[model samples]
Target: MKVAMVASHYPLPSHREEFVARVHQVADAFRRTPGCLTADCWLSADGDAVVSTVHWESEAARDASLATVMTAGLDIGYDERESRPREILHLVAR
Candidate 1:
């Protein structure tokens, strides 16, 4: 199972490195929480938005991980927030 998280903030870019380090720290704190395969992060060129993805071994794992996230107060409300499927029409041509 794959989950994507997108966030935006005025100062998010300035603290990208700090944010990434903290993300790792949080993942470590929840190491035993199950359902977390890995988390990867990306930043926009303009430095205001960020996108992250998490892959779980299974749907059950994803659900469990989400539960933990909620319990852990892992909420970042954007100036604008959206929850929708990011359409991927095609993969690599190769």
Candidate 2:
């Protein structure tokens, strides 16, 4: 079944643009990955959060990509609050 992985991150105002750039890079990489249907990154209207969603052909595919895609060179920045963990969700169509 198709799966969508969604995650939202809160970054300090100073880090928002840089964080989004890194996320966009990762999303671009996923677009070339096998079994990745599509990937997208967006900023919250208030610019306090960055949200990303990557659609995969299956749950297994998403799991498989984690090993590589996550290592694609982006790191959590110091400006990101440690107190606030990312909110993530996995979804499937009803």
Candidate 3:
């Protein structure tokens, strides 16, 4: 199963460049984890928030990854919005 996490920051007072730097560093860890097939993240162009889509070997792997990501202190409404996990339908290759 794959997990798509959308973390919405509630309009923090911090500077844009500072927020992006922290978010980008944490996002990098997702790419280096074992069993992580795909990990990609992007900030909202308006500079409000960031979201990341991560693919794992199995549901267990997905769950573990999500836990780790949340622990890093990103501004995610974990309690407000439910976490979502979906099975991958296809993967295109070059």
Winning model by TM-score: 2
TM-score of 3: 0.53
| Alpha-carbon runs more than 4 Å astray in model 3 | 11-13, 67-94
What's the CA RMSD of model 2 in angstroms? 2.2
Per-residue accuracy of model 2 over 19-81 as CA lDDT, tens digit each: 888788888888877889999999888877799899999888888776678777767344434
lDDT-wise, the better of 1 and 2 is 2
Residues 1-94, candidate 3, lDDT per residue (tens digit)?
A: 4434444432353444554565566667766666677766566777555445556676666667767876866654333222232123333222
The C-alpha lDDT values of all candidates are 0.51, 0.80, 0.54
RMSD per candidate (Å) reads 6.4, 2.2, 6.9
Q: What is the per-residue lDDT of model 1 for residues 29-88, given as tens digits with 9 covering 90 to 100?
A: 445567566665566687554445455666667678767776786533232232232222
**lDDT value for candidate 1?**
0.51
Local lDDT at 74 for model 3: 64
Q: Give the range where candidate 2 is weakest over 10 consecutive residues by summed lDDT.
A: 74-83
Could you estimate the TM-score for every candidate?
Answer: 0.50, 0.85, 0.53
Rate residue 61 of model 2 by lDDT: 84
